[model samples]
Target: MPHDLNRLFPLRPARVHEVCGPSAMSFAAIASARAQGDFLWIREGWQPDTLNPVALSEMADPARLLIARTANQIESLAVAEEALRDGAIPLVVIEVTRPLDLREGRRLQLAAKNGQTTGLCLIPEGMGSNAAETRWHAAPLFDPGGADSTLMRWEIIKNKTGTLGFWDVRWNAAAHRLDVVSPAGE
Candidate 1:
């Protein structure tokens, strides 16, 4: 059976979703790369790590990426909310170092709904407490026997639809997107 990403993951538009774990950034990148057209990615200025253009090119068109760096977490959230409310971008991704409170999460939810845009929040592992449409936990899957180290394990920790599952996925360079290698039995 074909593992349709949209059907398997089902990231609803006009809602904010959460991605947490060691490879949360990668997982968020994969989602953005799969989306059509350009996207906005917001990060804190304090974050020393920068998004690699070449690396992003593997799954997404780096030239279409628009990045915004905020001076701090508060600024980052503000920018994200504004971008999300603008309804111009199809996808808005925000990397947050701290957990989002209930009020903050509600604000994002309203913004996304108003703009009809999808928001992806990259959070630290085990630090999610938001009203997200779905919450995903991603981690690198070690496969010493395999040559590729990009393999990842993903689990749906929370879903509004009440669907929960896990899968082993990897970036298909040839396909220019993520592919589910196998739907691990829950």
Candidate 2:
């Protein structure tokens, strides 16, 4: 079995991990379970917050989730960079509608790595190029079994050290664990 997110896809602490596709938010919430500690969500203030508190409560400690608003991508990234370096927060999820330059991207990785924290960068559709250690393109798929479970269909667009594969993500609220279900067709 894959030991860490790196093996699962291309996620690692101290590296910029990009998540895209139609269900990026859902993917982000599910992926966040892999990382522990306080959560940091950085996004534009203008955008509506679609995070479901009850659903998140089933995954991580909902009380630790913090949402920060920024005026632009630069500030959001800058805040993310600083937060990653603190080492206090374990997971920093940045919602970006724009692309980051190489230097800024590198800084995010370095900061996260130096602080031993996980950095999850969520990029919306048509916002920017997928750039990171691993880029996950995901969309929600109706459960074939007609259960209440949510199946997150995803493809590893860019995987540096992991094999390319597709899987359906199912979150078990009771167990609070993420299970990779049968691989779905593209």
Candidate 3:
């Protein structure tokens, strides 16, 4: 994790974490950018939302991304699990459209731990009662045209390590990193 992210969200290595809400992908991308080395990203093949290379390049080298497009949710999970288990990549992010069952979550968790890699699941809706190390909900704080367009809020809804809180943050485009505006309800 990057120094700035470590301060707000200290993620444990060799564990699976979840990111929920509409901005989940963006949040995941930002975190992945901070992470070192090449990474694998698994997403549904039919999903309309495509990642923009230009936007991604602002945070990190876009060429370092290894993308895997799957036919369905099941395939996505399978690919993610296999990638995590391989332990070659430093980070693995999967776009999950459905909630993961306990067994599925646990499998991913174990794979991550065994491989000594970090896994981030982008869940459209929050995953419930799973083996994830932490669950974060991310949302934009304002519209793009607004004065605080870059502002966003990330809430740590669940954590196995006992840390819980939310922070108002903004992306510093020039700095290519997240800047904490305020620690909400700390």
lDDT of each: 0.84, 0.76, 0.82
Better by TM-score, candidate 2 or 1 = 1
lDDT of 2: 0.76
Better of 1 and 2 by lDDT: 1
- Residue 101 C-alpha lDDT in model 2: 70
> Which candidate tops TM-score?
1
* Top-lDDT candidate index: 1
Q: How close is candidate 2 to the true structure, as a TM-score?
A: 0.87
lDDT at position 139, candidate 2: 89
Comparison by TM-score, 1 against 3, better one: 1
lDDT per residue (tens digit) for residues 87-139 in model 2: 89888899987777777778887888888887888886644443477788898
Model 2 spans with C-alpha error above 4 angstroms? 1-6, 126-131, 184-186
RMSD of 3: 3.6
